[model samples]
Target: MMEIRMILGLFLMITAASGWNVTFESPTVTVHMHETLSVAFTAIVTEADVANGTVVVSTTRESVASVDDLPVLDSSTVNDLVWSSNLVVSGNFLGNADILLSIVSPDQENKTSDALSVIVIREERIIDTLFTVFVAVMVSIMYINFGAAMDWPLCKRTLKRPIGPTIGFVCQFVWMPLLSYGIGLVLFPDDPELRLGMFFAGVSPAGGASNIWTVILGGNLNLSVTMTTISTLAAFGMMPLWIFTLGSTIFNSANLGVPYSRIAMFAVGLVIPLGIGFLIQKKLPRVSRILVRILKPLCSLLIIAIIVFAIITNLYLFQLFSWRIIVAGIGLPWLGYLFGYLLALVLRQPGPDITAISVETGVQNTGISIFLLRFSLPQPAADLTTIAPVSVAIMTPIPLTILWIVKLIMDRRKKSIAASAEKLQGSTEPIPTVSASTKTDNTENP
Candidate 1:
């Protein structure tokens, strides 16, 4: 237990150091057209042994100038820092423009800080607002389905089986990501955007709500909890390595740009929410339960809302490249579940184990994917944001539907066997026949 706690603590620290504590000094700014503006930003470090870190800062200013138009007047680095770049903003400068800054440290593996930003006043429209709504809707549906499943007595029963939960956790955190990456190679061979999307999905640890899913599926709750804890802790390092290694290998093969800082940010977003959830679960189980009940639905709704909004916002992109994105989107999640189940079967796991593994393997941390898509990809901001959520949105309903079908089939089979046994026993029993002749004979004899 002490070792586990230590490991967990280490995991949190790594995640916090690598992924969290990213903030913009001024997220929003206003400046006049044709005026040179400068903004100061800071990257605050909060962890130890950070080795080297990089920061990418960007702004939206299509109306005023292209990114090249904004150039850094002066740049300097201090405290074990080796590299820094001054951004030149270019293009039409009418409304809003973005300035980007990147920082890299060579030898430090601890907490570090940097500051950079640019000045330009452009009208900012709420982009992907509708998509946000769609994400919400999908999150809601998932929560409802999950909540209903939790009401089943079999849920608890299934969870009590040890092998099931253990296998489930292993498959989810360890195997599923590998499978997703392999599949991405086949499906999006030449497309960096799609490949990265798939890879990101694979690397993210299972969401906190997976514990709830385990309970719903009747897998051992303690095992699920343990797995969730362990996997999340493991994800701190695993996610970064996966993103860096796989992203570079695959995206480089395709000549697609992979942004490291953005990926780090994505990891941070996932880890923070998850860490908070774990802390809550540990410190206050009852409160955590209530929050889960509330947040699960909210997450489902948010996911659905994001999907619908993506469709609408990117209607043009979809119209042009619908087949490519659609096929990959639909295929990835199903593939995830399929491979997950296959792995469990190969391991000779029991039914409950199979179910737990299936859920864990099939569900990717879509939220992380969204953050990556929005921030990291080389594509236009609108295009990447519009398409990223499709991966999760398209895939979310599938496993739930399949699980429901499996449950129904299993239940019917169980009932039929029970009924058949009862019928056979009744048939074997001798029936006592009270014949009229017997009564008459008895009376006469008497």
Candidate 2:
């Protein structure tokens, strides 16, 4: 019995000698990007063997954060050996990661502590604030410009035919949502945020830029404007319906109770600007024409600004970008363009109407997608998911730009040929003419 008790005591001592516990003043730390945070912690060593242990701190995700070793500030002898120190952490990106602390004893045995959660956030800047406000104001003005250019009679007539708008509606809501969902599933099967982002990008209404492109490419501008208006209005119901249904499935099959009131507010925001534009066109015709003239350039500038600012603000996300993400992004708008064109073609629509539908279908209001993601998801996730719309927005205009260049070249060539024909006609000598008497004298001499 005495020998058995001795062995049990030895085992207990050995077990205790290999065990250590670390406790932080706080279990979780939150830091801003480009900032540092210091956390104080205490390590309790119950055994004499680990009295001179070395502490090492590490983060699970290096991209998210970097943690420094625990610097010992003091040591004390009490019931057991205790060391107190501060763990220094630096935030590198926006996300959540785990911080782990381990102590290595003289015997090279390691004792690891429980994980500590860390969150990194992007600090807001003056430029971000200004950019948000500028986008809001510019979009409103652009819509007003769209209203100025709208032909109310033509819009009504297009509605009477309804084929063009119908095709656009199907393309915008049906084809786009499904395409985005499929692409998200195939490309980012494990990432729910990106999938949600793609889904929102698809479900957003057609932007006013569609109208600009239609006009630039000699499409049915009237129909494009009408479709934009209808699509914006329809989004009030369709967005939520799809969000609660298909969107929910993509997000772990959880029924996401989307904030309906916020969605309503957004819809109202869009409609109010459009209504203001319509009023300006009706009550102030001269101002409307001026707005119309500036619309194209202003919209172009806004597109550039959106791209540049989005890239600048979210530079960190670019690191997470992959070829799959790029493929998914390019697939959304490019496939949308092809699908819309084919659908319209199969329906035997007029060429101009086909162009209008294709443009409206391909170009989504990414601003709205970003807004919805921010509104729906929590911090970090909201910002992270924005990658989807931002990527799509960057890619959406490429094909349109190419088409615009082609149209410009063709127009110049046509003008050159017409000018050459005119010059040749002008330079050609008049056919030699003969008087009746000259002709008779020539005949007699012959």
Candidate 3:
């Protein structure tokens, strides 16, 4: 019966894919004239009974524009894939346009792969590019600002304290990932995109922002820094392993099979950059400092740009499925944090330690998840693309917000305690006194 049900499900999916329906990972994109855009397309083949399959993709300007006015752009096909010939658009085609991509398989009677639609808007506004750059800068700034403090000799000494480094490492690698898995399981059981996002979050090591959180929470800053370093290094291996394992499981459950090579590619993309950065940092401290500074801001800008692009592209998804997604996004992070804090508490750790663990466990690497979804999954890339940003936008802010709230409360408490102590000190001070002889004379004479 189970096997039969699985067969039925597969049949239904194939049926859904064969029609002339339009699907887009991102419905709209903002681009400048001469700017290049890349879009992914898929064709699902259902029936084994047909022949002569071919797919054609074309774009039509919204206006009744002339072919000459449409700009003489070129297109190319690579293995069943079609893409814009150049990364840059040289045409004057501006405003909204419909990009039509079709797949026709000769041997198959029905082909039902979900088609991804990408829009090309021609303009010279540098907003998205600038935003991407800004995100990168912010990320670099975070790393440098926090990373410098970790270099101090005293910080190194403090890191060697009893179980400090061990605990920190555990929080960075083991506890946080496990906690993220638990959160994903609970909050996004039905949504593959959300689940994948959570899985990515679980696998990602704490970035530099963690160091700041540790200091603010009164945990050993040195320990946090050390943990972040170790985790970031270990991520080259662990991140891929965790993603492959968890992603395979999640995709399998969702009837999508992910290939091992795809997983390898993702790991390589992530780790190579990280490894290069680490090597530069180790080999040339001065150069590394400069790179880190540049990269931090660049990373921040990239993150924001990616997020904005994602949101803009999937505007329809957000509008259509707003309530369900919003709830999952808001609830999942909180649940993750709660679990992390509980885990820390159970271990009998300090409040700051607990806070660190909570944030690390709850905050995930949404970017990595997006990459995997875009490149690795067997399902239509468009679905993954749309889902990726939605999931990240929903999940990323949760931990950051929670951490901020925790910081505020901690700050207020510290101030209140200081004020109370000052008041007590003032009340208990001794009054001024006259000399002993003067006092005695006054008393006796009187």
Candidate number achieving the greatest TM-score relative to the actual structure: 2
Write model 1 residue lDDT over 104-208, tens digit each, in one string. Answer: 345543332222233333233366544444444453343333332232244355456656656656676667667667766877675555666666776766664
Q: What lDDT does model 1 reach?
A: 0.54
What is the TM-score (0 to 1) of candidate 2? 0.75
Runs with alpha carbons beyond 4 Å of true place in candidate 3: 1-194, 290-302, 320-324, 378-382, 385-436, 439-446
- Full ranking by TM-score: 2, 3, 1
Each prediction's total of clashing residue pairs, residues at least 3 apart in sequence or on different chains, is 69, 0, 40
* Predictions: Cα RMSD each: 17.8, 8.2, 12.3
In candidate 2, which residue pairs get closer than 3 Å at backbone N, Cα or C atoms, i.e. clash?
none
TM-scores, all candidates, are 0.54, 0.75, 0.56
Angstrom error of the Cα, residue 272, model 3: value is 3.2
What ranges in model 2 sit over 4 Å off?
1-24, 41-58, 70-86, 101-114, 143-152, 190-193, 248-261, 278-293, 312-317, 320-325, 371-379, 410-446
Better of 1 and 3 by lDDT: 1
Worst 10 residues of 3 by lDDT: 64-73
lDDT tens string, model 3, 1-446? 42343343345444545564433445544454345554333223322211344433333432211111111112223323322222222233332343443444555443333422333333423753453444444344434433432344554675566354565566556665676566567766755555665566556666444455455556655556566666655776887777667657876765555667766765555544455555666677887677645543454455555566657644544433555455555554555556667767887877766766665555554544454454554322334334533564466565675667887998899999999999999899698879999989999998
Better of 1 and 2 by lDDT: 2
